[model samples]
Each structure stands twice: as C-alpha cells, then as structure tokens.
Target chain A: MQILLASSFGAYLFALFRKEFIYAGVLLQLAYLLFRASELGRLPLVGPHDTIVFFTACAAAFSLPFGRLMKGEKAFGNIISVSSALFTALALVYEPRNFPLPPVLKTFWFETHVVLAFMSYALFGVAAVFGYLYLKAPQSLAETLQYKAVLIAYCLFTLSMIFGGIWAYLAWGTYWLWTPKELWTSILWIFYSFYLHARLRQWWAGRPAAVLGIAGFGVVMFTYLGVSLLMKSSHSF
Target chain B: MNPLKKIYQILLSLNTSLWLLLIITALFIAGAFIMPDNPGFGSIDIPLFDWLKRQNLESVWWLWGTIGVLSLLSVNTLFCSIDSIIKKRRVTHWLLLISPQVIHTGFLFMLLAHLLGASGSYHGEAAVAEGSAVKLSGGDILAIKNIEIETDDSGYLSGWGVDIEYNHSGNFTESARISPNSPFIYKDLNIMVKDVQAYPEAALLQVSRDPGAVWALAGSILFTLGILTLIALRMKMEKT
Candidate 1:
C-alpha cells in the first residue's frame, strides 16, 4: 500500500509537467484502494489514512474534468498535481492498519455517507484550486468555474450530511449531535452558504468571493482532520 | 419609509441572511473550541436546549447567541421566500426564481424539525442481559430475548445484534431485532443497540423519541430537490 501510494504521489508530481500523468496517478490510487479493500473485506475508508487516500484519489479524478474546464491552463494543472501529491504524502504519514469494520459502521447509510462526504471534500478541494487560479489570473472563466464547482460541491455536501443525519438517527437516535466534528461540519456548511450569498453582493463578486472559496478549503480540512486530532469526536480514528 | 415596511424590507434582504449566517458561523467555531473543556454542553442523554437551560450565562453564551441569530435568520428566510413568491408570480422563467424559494422552505422545515426535537425529544439508556425486562419511561417494557455476536476468523469482533420484545401493561405486543442500523420503533419511540458485551451476553440500548425525524426527512428531501433543480437550471443556462 505504501509503495502504491508513493508511486501515485510520483505520478501526480510528474503530472505537474505532463497532463497525462494525472491518469496514471488516479489509476494507481484506485488500484491501491481495491487491493486494500480486498484484503480488509470491506471499504477501506475507516480511518484517516484510508479516507485521505480516497479523498486524494477523488481529487485526482476530479482534476481531469476540471483540468479540461480550465482550457488546459498549465497553472491549474500544476496546482492540482501539487495538491494531490501533498494529500497522498499526508496519507502516507499515517500508519496503515486493517482494522475490522465496527458494527456501527456496518450500515449502508454509513458507507454512502462516507463516500458522499469525501467526494464533496474532493470537489471542494478542486473549487479551492480554481479560487487560487482566479486570484492569480482574475479571469471570468476561472471565477465562473469556481462558483460552479462550489455549487455542485455544496449540494453533494448537503446530501452527505442528510445521509449522515439519517444514519445517526437510526444508530444514535438523533439527527444532529453536539460533537466538535458535527459542529465543524455545520460551520463548513454555513461558511459555504455565506460564500454563496456573498457572491451576490457587488463588492464581493470577484476577489472577495475567490478568497472565500480558497478559505473554504481550509474549513474543510479542519473539519475533516483537525477536529479528530484536537478534539474528542466520534470521527476520531 | 414606514417603520413596519422598513423592518419588513430588512427581513427580506439577502444581506440580512449573509450577516446572520456569518455571525452564526463564528459562534459555531467558538463553540467548537469551547466544547472540549465543557463536555456537558454536548450531553447526549438530554436535549441540547434543555441542557443549555441549566448552564450559566457566561459558560454557554455562544450557544444562546447562536439560537438568537438562528431565530432571526429563520424569520428572514421566511419573509424572503414569501416576498419572492409574490413578486415572481408572473415571471416566465419560473424554475429559476422558485428554486431559491424551495430552498428557503426546506430551511424553514429543518428549523421547525430542530425546534420540535429540542422541546420534546426524550433520550435514555438501559443495560440489560438476555431474558431481562426493563420498563421504559412511558410504561412500555423491553424484554431482551437473545444476543447475537459474530466474529471473524481472526477473532476480531465483526458484528452483533439484539433480539427484543416490546410489551405494554402485562400484554405481549411485538418482537423485533435491533442491530446497528436497524432500530426497533414503537410509534415515536426508538430502541437502538448502542453496545454489546460478550461472556455474559449483555447489551446497552438507547431509547429515544424524536418528534422531528419525519420533519427532518421532509426538509432534507425538499432541500436536496431544490438544489438539484437549481444545479440543472444553472447548467442549462450555461449551455445556452
């Protein structure tokens, strides 16, 4: 698994210069996931290591579409490559362990919830990359793509939260919990909602909105990892 | 401008929502940091608002502030949706205009769900072994019939489930099995397996009543539908 992850990271690094390498990175990550899943006899998205790798894979796959949308902007390709490589490297920092799936996570709702949630996180990562591109070049295409990316990401995140709520209600008897992770999730959602509304104002349409887009990825990262690391959360793994 | 009209306009403005959401987000961030030291703020056994009622002002001011801002935001959302519907009643581009209103309606429904939950929800836990009966708060009896624990070949715990019987007033009612995702429900009451222990074959079960579950599901459906519609419309516009 570590070798595959390292190879994927190398492919993404190579993608910084050649766009075709992105596909190689994505394929390697997918292979790693499949191999890990076959070994574990379940989805490998149980801990920080597995989920981060999955998220990186999602980002790399999403970058293909987003890369085309950006009209093959070299900077866009480079940002995605470097970001994905960094995420893969981060995943490699954690020790790989194949723990049996907990009974609470054996539900279909739990699996769907994790998949949707991580997919949104990946999309948000793409949106933030576009936000960075917009800030660098200030093009109408970059700004519009940033908004579109965020819009889709917001919807997916909403659905993920809904599935999570249902799962929690069935498993824990409440739609919402008062844990730090849940609170941070709400914070991330509200922050994006604020960004969506902020885009309507004349003063915030371009640079300010772009900045918020970039800042949102920060919120996502903190919600995904920081909450687990710094606080006592059910999401801690 | 008339004072009432001014207030109405303020409540219907998009800026009001942005500002309120910003405040609420800030308060939530503060609460996240504060929650670690103040664990009671997140007690799962009691309703959150009820727990807040017992907390002093200084300790839980962020929560109080969040509730206040959320209330204002709800009112703003309601007014904005009503105003949009009335103003766009004649527009030909109906889907474009109504998508946001649908989102607003969903938001209102979710708020209502939370309100119902906070004011009326009940939660408690019971530990029981097989063949033992426990009385719930509302007079129903939960009798554990069997405990099933499954393990993998490596001796790692894989899964567990509990079989239970619900009875009322010395009469046999119904029998059901409760697992991780499958909860046994009797009307509004829900019984879920929280934990299972081996050797003695005991389980910990949580009983809860959430009056808002249906409302929340309704709200989630509407919210998801509205967003999907908006995304479709936006994509179409971009294509054209």
Candidate 2:
C-alpha cells in the first residue's frame, strides 16, 4: 500500500511535469484508497499506519479539485503530492500493528474523536502546504484557501477535543486531565485561536497569517507525534 | 474616567485578550515540557488551585502565573462579549455579530463549570469483590453483584462487565451494568469499573461526582455550534 501510494504521488508529480498524465495519477490514488479500505475492511483510519495513509489519501483527493480550481498553479499540487508521499513513507516507517480494538476503544465517541481529529490534522496539513505556496507565490486564492481550510480544521479540532473529553470522562471519571497530550492539544488549539484572531488584524492578515499557518502545522506535528514518542503520558495511542 | 469603567475597558480590550492568550500559551507549553509528571492531578477531586498553591512556589511560579493570566482572560472574555454585543446591536449581520459572543459565552460557561467542579467534586476508587459493598460519601453505598470477564483465544481480556446495585439510606435504589464504555450514573455520581483482578476476583471501581459536567458539555456544544454558525455566515457573506 505504501509503495502504491508513493508511486501514485510520483505519478502526480509526473503529471504536474507532463500535464497529460493527471488522470493516471488520480486513478492510482483512487486504487490505493480502495485497496487499503478493502484490506482493512473499513476506512483506513484505525491505527497510526492507517491514519497516515488516510491522511495521504485525503490530501491527494483534495488536491484533485484544488488543482482544477486553481489552474496554472501546479506548484500547489506538487506540494500536496510531495507531502502526501512523505506522510505515506512515514506511515510505513511507523509500521502500526493491527492490534484488536480494546473494549475502551469500542465506543462511538472513540471513532468520532479519532476520525474528526485526523481529518482536521489532514486539513491543517493541506493548509500548511497552501501556506508555503502562498509565501512562494502570494496568490489571493491561496490565502483564501488556507483560511478556509483552517476554519474547518479548527471546528473539527474543537469537536475532537470535546469528544475526547467526553470519552475520558466516561472511562476515567474525569473530563480534563493535565496530561502532556492534553496540554499540547490545548496549546495547539490556542495557537490556532491566536492565528485566527491575528488573521483579522491588518498587520497580520496576509504573509504573517501564512507564516502562522505553517508554524501551526509544526505545532500540530509535535502534538500528534512528539507527545506520543518523546513523553510518557496516559494517551498510549 | 471612573476606576470601574477603566477596569471594564481594560477587560474589553482585544489587545488584553491577545496578550493574555500568548502568555497562557507560553505557560501551557512550559507546563507540557518542563513540569514533572504528576498523575494525582488527573483526579477530579483534586482542587487544582489549592494543589498549585501547595506545590513548591519557586518550581511552579509559572503555573501560578498561568492561573492568574487565565483568570484575567476569563474576565476579559466576559467583558469582550458584552462589549461586542452592545457595540454590534445595530449591525445588519446579526448572525456574524452574535456567533462570536455565543462562543465567548460558552467559554465562560466552561470556565465556570471547571470552577464549580474543582470546589465541589468528589472522586475515589474502591476495590470490591463480588457481594461486597463500598460505602460512599453522602451515606450512599454500592454493592457489586457479579463480575463477568470475556477472554480471547490467547486468554487475554477481550471485555469485562460488572453489575452494581446502588443503595441509598440502606435501601436498594437501582441496578446497573458497568462496562468499559458504559458508566453508571446515579444522581450526580458516576460509577465506572476501572480494573479487574483475577484470583481475588475483585473489581476496582472509580466513583466520581462532578456537578459541572453537564454544564461543561453544554458549553462545549454551544461553543461548537457558535463556531459553525460563524463560519457559515462568513462563507455566505463571502459568497454574496
């Protein structure tokens, strides 16, 4: 699956270089998603490996319409394709095992929380890609796209946090824990809140907002991977 | 200008909010990275403010500062919401104007819930074997009736369930099945089976009373709805 995703991303790059190969890349992306879903017997969002693949799929899928919407902006597509490929490769490196779901995880809130959180992360990833593109090209459309993506991501992230709190309360008898993961998650949310508010200010609206968007993705990466790997916390996933 | 009016202006200042947010973020980042791991803080019964005060003052000065900033931010949020509502009363885009206030109100409600919970909540755990009773505060008692555990092929625990009977004033009130995801709520108390031990055949049940959970949940829902409404209205305005 990783190989196919990497190859599909390569095809996307090739299509960007040679404009006529776009359909081949799209077909490969769709095939990869289908194969992965079939293999997992569900959406590719169960574990770390699956989540990475799922995020890569989302980036590739969004790139199709985004690429078409912003014609002559092949760089945006290239950025997303490269990022997706990198994530897919990272997924392979992480090599998440298909452990059976624990009883605690077999809840509606767990699925909703994980899915929404990952979806928001993927959107933020895209926004970061756009932020980079905007810094390079300074297009109004890129700015708008980055803002819109962050808006949606913020909403989903909020919902994910809330659902997580509810799940925590159900399992642990506490809604808010001052664990490292929770702290970082709150920081990520606050950072974006600042970003959103700053975007409204005239001085910070354009390139500065783009910079914050990119920086926010760095925070997102740290929140997602850093706490899990670098720190000891209750969020074992 | 009157002193009270000056304070209100300061609280309503967006500049104050931005600065407070920055400080709070920095403090949280420091807490996440620098503070030693203390599992005891996760308990609902621990009053965070009291606990912070009890910590080594030198080591946790940042925490103290963070609390101060957060308190200020809460006040700022309240005043900012009021100021916005008053200022934007005649604005044609009522949805756009009010959505942020709704989010602010939700934020305040959540903060208030945390405050109420920190002072009034109770949390404790008890290990009870089958047919044993655990006494709780307010003269409540919980009796464990049965313990069921399901194991996979490798003898690993797949699932576990506990049947508990709530007794108040020595009278049986209700029975509940407590499982991993399903917690029993009796009055304001939540009873959840935390762990199961074999041989001894005991279940560790955590009981907590959080009077503010409902308010916090409602606040979260309202906050989410407010953001969605703001986004929808903004999108519509952009389209138009």
Candidate 3:
C-alpha cells in the first residue's frame, strides 16, 4: 500500500513536469486513497500513520480545484506531490499494528473533532505552499489563493477546536484543559486570528500576509506533532 | 470632546483591541512556558482561580497579569463590537456587516460563561465501592450500585462503567450508567467514572458542577455559525 502511494506521488511529480499526465496522476492517487479507506473499514484518520496518509490524499484532492482556480495547476501539483511523498515516507516510521480504537475515542464527537482538524491542516498545508510561492514570484493569483485557503482553514480550525472541546467535556467533564496540546492549539488559532486581522490593514495585505501564512503553517506543524511528541498529555499520538 | 466620549473612542479603537490581543497572547505564551510542570495542572479538578489565589501573588504575578489583561481585552472587544454594529447599521450587506459582530457576541458570551464558571463551579473526586454512598454538594447523595470492568484477552482493561443511583434529600431518584466518554448528568452536576480497581471492586469517580457549560456551548455554536456565514458571503462575492 505504501509503495502504491509512493508510486502515485511519483506519477504526480512526473505529471507536474510534463503537464500531460495530470489527470491520470490524480486518478491514481484518488484510487489509492479509496483502496486504503476501504481496507481500513473506516475513514483513514484513526492514528498518526493513517492521518499522514489521509492528509496526503486530501492535499492531492484539493490541488485539483485550487490549482485550476489559481492558474498554477502544475506548481500546485508539484507541491502536493512533494508533501505527499514526504509524509507517506514519514508514516513508514511507525510500526504497523491493528490496535482497536481506545474506549475514549468511541464517540461521534471524537471522529468529528479529529477529521475536521486534520482537514483544516491539509488546507493550511496547501496555503503554505502557495504562500511560499507567492513570496518567490509575487503574483496576484497566488496571493489571493493563499488568502482564501487560509480563510477556509481558519474557519475549519475554529470548528475543530470547538468540537474537540465538546468531546473533552463529554469524556473528561471539562471543555478546556489547558494542557500543552490545548494551549499550543489555542496559540495556533490566535496566530491565524492575528494574521486575518492584520490582512485587513492596507499596509499588511500582500507580502506580509504571505509571510504570516507560511509562519502559521510552522505553528500548525509544531502544534500537531511537536506537542504530542515532546509533551506528556492526553492528546499524545 | 467629553471625557466619557473620549474613553469610549479609545475603547472602540481597532488599534487598541489589536494591542490588547497581542499582549494577552504574549502573556498566554509566557504562562505556558513559565508555569510549573504538573501533569494535572489544568485538569477540571483543579480550580484555576482558586489555585492562583492560594499561591503567593509575588510568585504567580504572571497569572494575575494575564487575567487582568484578559479582562481589559474583554472590555475592548465589547466596545469595539458595539461601535462596529452602530457604524454598519445602514450597510446594504447586513450579513457581511454583522457577521463579525456575531462572532464578537459569541466571544463575549464565552468569557461570561468562564467568569460564571470560575465563581460557582465545584469539582471533587471520590472512590466508592459497590453499595457505598458519597455525599455531594447541595445535600445530594450518590450511591454506587455496581461496577463493571471489561478486559481484553491479555487482562488489560478495555472498558469500565459504574452504575450509580442518585438520592435527592433521602428520596430515591434516577439511576445511570457512567462510562468512559459518557458522563451522568443530574441537574448541573456531572459524574463520571475515572478509574476502576478490581480487587475491591471500586470505581474512582469525578464529580463536577458548572452552571455555565450551556452558555459556553451556545456561544461556540454561534461563533461557528458566524464564521460560516462570513465565509459563505465572501465566497459568493468572489464568485460574482
């Protein structure tokens, strides 16, 4: 399965360079995602390895629409391909196991919380790619794409945090625990909130927004992975 | 200009709100780094304000500073939201004009909920064997009827639940099964099984009461709706 994913990503890269096999590459990636989801018997979002693979699939899927709209379809595909390959390779580090879902995660709220949060992360991942490119090329389309992607991501992040809080209340009898994961997640949210507010100012619209978007992705990665690995908390993956 | 009007203008300034938010964010980051490393520091069982008050002010000045800045930010948020609502009252795109205000209103409600919870919430833990009764706040009693623990093939606990009966003023009341991710709520009180011991067949339960949970939930829902509305309007504008 991993080899198939890696091969599809390679195909995406080839399509990025050639610009002729883009549809075929997209179809291959989508098929791989479908196969993995069917095999898992649930959404491919339960564990870290599953989440990384699922995120890779989402990045490829999202690139199709966002790429066309931004007029940088090939560049977007290249970014998605690189990111998917990197994450899929990272997913291989964790030992594969068929552990049953923990009792605390056997709730609808938990599924909603994790899925929305990860989807937002994938959107922000795309935004960061465009944001970096905008910094390099300084195009209006890339700037607009970065802004819209972050806008959608910010909204989804808000929902994910709310859902997570509700799930915590159900499981632990508290909405907010102020654990390291919770605190850093709040920081990430506030970072993007500041970014959105700053974008409204005439002085901070284009280059500064791009910079912040890229920086916000750094915060997202730290919040998603760093806190779990470094800090002892209930959310440790 | 009148002094009261001057104060209102200052309060309503976007720059002031931005500065306040920045300061609060900084303080939060500082607190995250500077605070003592306790695994259970932020759990519901720990009353944050009460714990802070018990600590020496000189030692935990950052916490007090954070709280003070947050209060000022709340005021700033309220004034700015009201100012925007009044200024945009005549705009044609009412949804776009008011969406941010809806989010602001939600923020204020969540702050209010936190304030109410800080003042009135109660939390405690109790270890109860089967047929043991623990007295809760407001003179209510919780009686443990039975405790069940499901184990996997390796004898590791897969799941656990406690059957509890509530006695209100010596009158028999409702019974509930409290399990992981599922808590039993009686009025504003919530009871959940935290852990289980097999030798004596006892369950460690956590009990808490927060009157502001509903308000916080309502505020979160409103905030989500406001953001969705804003996004929908913006997307439509982009499409057009």
Candidate 4:
C-alpha cells in the first residue's frame, strides 16, 4: 500500500495522468479495509491508522470525477497528490493494532455515521483544493465546482450527524453531548452553514467565499483530529 | 423608521441570520476549548439547565451567551423564513422559493428538540447482579435474569448481552435482551446495558427518558430533505 501511494505521488510529479494511480491506491485501501473487517468481524474504523486510510481512499475516489474538469491545471493535480501522500504518510505513523470493537461502537448506526461523515469530509477536502485552485487562477468552473461540492457535502454531513445522533441516543441516552469533539463538530457544521449563506450574498460571493471553503476544511481536520488529540472525548480515535 | 418596525426589520433580515450564525460558530469554537477543562459540564446524567445553573458563571458564561444568542437566531430564522415566503409568493419557481424556508424550519425544529431535552429529561444507572432487581423511579422493577459475555482469546470482550425482565406495578410484564446499540424501550423509557461482568455475572444498566428524540429525528429528516431539494434546484438552474 505504501509503495502504491508513493507511485501515485511520483506519477503526479512526472506530470503523468495521475488519476489511475490514485484509483489503484483507493482500490488497494478498500481491499485492505474489507480484509480487516472480515478478520475482526467488524468495521475497521476504530483507530487513526484505519480511519486516515479510509479518509484518504474516500478523498481519492471522490477526486476522480473532477479530474477531467481539473485538466490543464497542474497545480490542482499537484495539490491533490501532495495532500494525499502527506495524509497516507501520516497514517503510517500510527500503529495498526487490531482491537475488539467496543460496546458503544457495536451498532449499524455507528458505521453509517462514520462512512457518511468521512465521505463528506473527503468532498469538503476536494472543495478546499478547488478553492485554492480558484485563487491561483480565477475561473468560473473552479468556483462552480467548489459550490456544488460544498452543497453535496453539506447534505451528506447533515445525514451523518443524524445517524450519529441516533447512535448516541441509543447508547448514551442523549442526542447531543457537551464534549470538545461534539462542540468542534458543531463549529464545523456551522462554519459550512455560514459558507453556504455567504455564497448567496453579494459581498461574499467570490474570494471571501473561496477562503471560507479553504478554512472550512481546517475546521474539518480540527474536528476530526485536533479535538481528539488535544482534549478528552468519548471518541476513541 | 418606527422602533417596532425597525426591530421587525432586523429580525426578518438574512444579514441578521448570517451574523448570528457567525457568532454561534465563534462561541462554539471557544466552548470546544473551555469544556475540556470543566469536565462534567456537558454531562447527560443531569438536566442541562440545572447543571448550568450550578456552575461558576465565569466558566459557564459562554454557554449562557450561546443559549441566549441561539434563541435570538431562532427568532431571526422564523421571521426571515416567513418574510421570504410572503415576498416570493408570486414566484413561478415554487420549490426554489420554499426550500430555504424548509431548511430554516428544520433548524428551528432541532433547536426546539434541544430545548425540550435540556428542560426535561431523566437518566438513571444501576449495577445489578444476576437474580437481583432494581426499582425504578416510577415504582416499576427491572430484574436481571441472565448475563452473557463473549471474550476473545486475549480476554478482550467480543460481545455481551444482558437479559432483563420488566415488572409494572408489582406485576410481571415482559422479558427482553439489552446490549450495546440495542436498547430496550418500554413506553418513553429506554434501558441499555452499559457494562457486563463475568465471574459474578453483573451488568451496568442505564435507563433514560428523552422527550425530544422524536423531534430531533424529524428535524434531521427535514433538514436533509430540504438541503437535497435545494441542491437539485441549484444544479438544475446551473445546467440551464
């Protein structure tokens, strides 16, 4: 898996059509995820290693559909490849130890919540990249792609939160928790909600909207990783 | 402008909504840092409003401020949504005109759910060994019938379940199994097995009553539907 990821990065460096390499990496990761799930009898999303890999796979898979639109834009491809490689490399730093699924995570809603959440995160990630590319070269296509990506991501993120609420209610008896992670998740959601509304306004239509898109991903990362590392939360990984 | 008309205009403006949302986002960002130091500040075992009242005002001022602003935002959302529909009532694109209002309504429903939950909810937990029973607040009884646990070769718990029998008014009612993710519900009450012990065969069970869960679920469905509908409309507009 490491070698395939490196090859994708190298292909991007060589100015080759890198979509195929990313697709290959995504396939390998998916296969590994399935194999681990079969071995453990549960979804392999418990630890940082598994989740980061899953996140990278989702980002790579979702980025492909925008490949043609991003053609002739070298910086766009470069950003995607470099970030993918950086994230996969970060995943490698974590020990991939197998552990039994905890009682709280033993739910259909939990898995659904995770899958939808990460997929939405991946879409937001792609939108952030488009936002950056738009900054480099102001193009209507880039802006449109960013808006559409955010629109889809917002819907999916809402669904993920819904599933997560149900799961929490079933296990913990409350739909909302006052933990750091939950707070940051709300912040992320509200930030995007702000972005959505900003687009509809005249003053914030272009560059400010693009900047919000970029910063929105920062909120995503902080909500996903920073909160876990910096604060005590029920989220294990 | 008349003072009443100015206040109404402020409540019905999208600008007010945007600014309120931004303020909420900032307050939550502050809260994400503040909450970790004040553990139990967000505990679900107690009613949220009561918990907030018991805390130090210095530490919990952000929370109070958030609640206050959220109330304002809710009013703003309601007013804006109503005003939009009235102004755009003649527009041919009916779905486009109503989608934002639907989203606003969903947001209001969610806020209402939180309000209901914060004001009135019940939570209780008990550890019961096999053959022992715990009396509930409502004079009902819950007895542990059996405990099952499955551990892996490394002694890690792989699976577990607790069988519980419910009695109402000193009369036998029903028997059910409770496990993680599978809570037993009787009326508005929910019973979940939080932990299990092996040698002595004991389990930690939590019973809770949430009056807002249905509202939350309804709000979520509406929120998702509104967003999806808006996205479809926007995409269609872009295509043309």
Best by lDDT: 1
Q: Write the per-residue lDDT of candidate 4 for residues B40-149, one digit (tens) a residue.
A: 66555777788888888867788898999999999998887887888889974999988878888888899998888888776888889999999998799999998999
Which ten residues in a row are the worst by lDDT in model 2 chain A? Answer: A40-49
Q: Rate the local accuracy (lDDT) of all candidates.
A: 0.88, 0.80, 0.77, 0.83
Clashes of 3: 0
Worst 10 residues of 1 chain B by lDDT: B39-48
Best by DockQ: 1
Worst 10 residues of 4 chain A by lDDT: A7-16
The docking category that best describes candidate 2 is medium
lDDT of 3 by residue, A1-237 (tens): 666666765665676566445455556656765676678555556657767666666666676788778664466667776676677677667644456566787788888888788888888888998888888889888888888889898998889988998888888777877666777787788788887887877777889899989988998898888877777657844
Report RMSD (Å) for each prediction in the order shown: 1.5, 2.6, 2.7, 2.0
Better of 2 and 3 by lDDT: 2
Report residue B195 deviation for candidate 4 (angstroms): 0.3
Off by over 4 Å in 2: A1-47, B1-4, B37-45
Model 1 stretches astray by more than 4 angstroms = B169-172
How many times do residue backbones clash in model 1?
Answer: 0
Candidate ranking under lDDT, highest first, comes to 1, 4, 2, 3
Cα error, residue B114 of model 4, in Å, equals 0.6
Candidate 4 runs further than 4 Å off: A1-19, B42-44, B170-172
User: Which digits, one per residue and each the tens of the lDDT, describe model 1 over residues B84-178?
Assistant: 88988897488888898888888889988998888888788888998898988657789999999988888977778799999876666898998
Alpha carbon deviation, residue B205, candidate 3 (Å) = 1.0
Task: Name the lDDT value of residue A35 in candidate 3.
Answer: 74
Angstrom error of the Cα, residue A15, model 3: value is 4.2
Q: Is the docking of candidate 1 incorrect, acceptable, medium or high quality?
A: high
lDDT of 3 at A133: 85
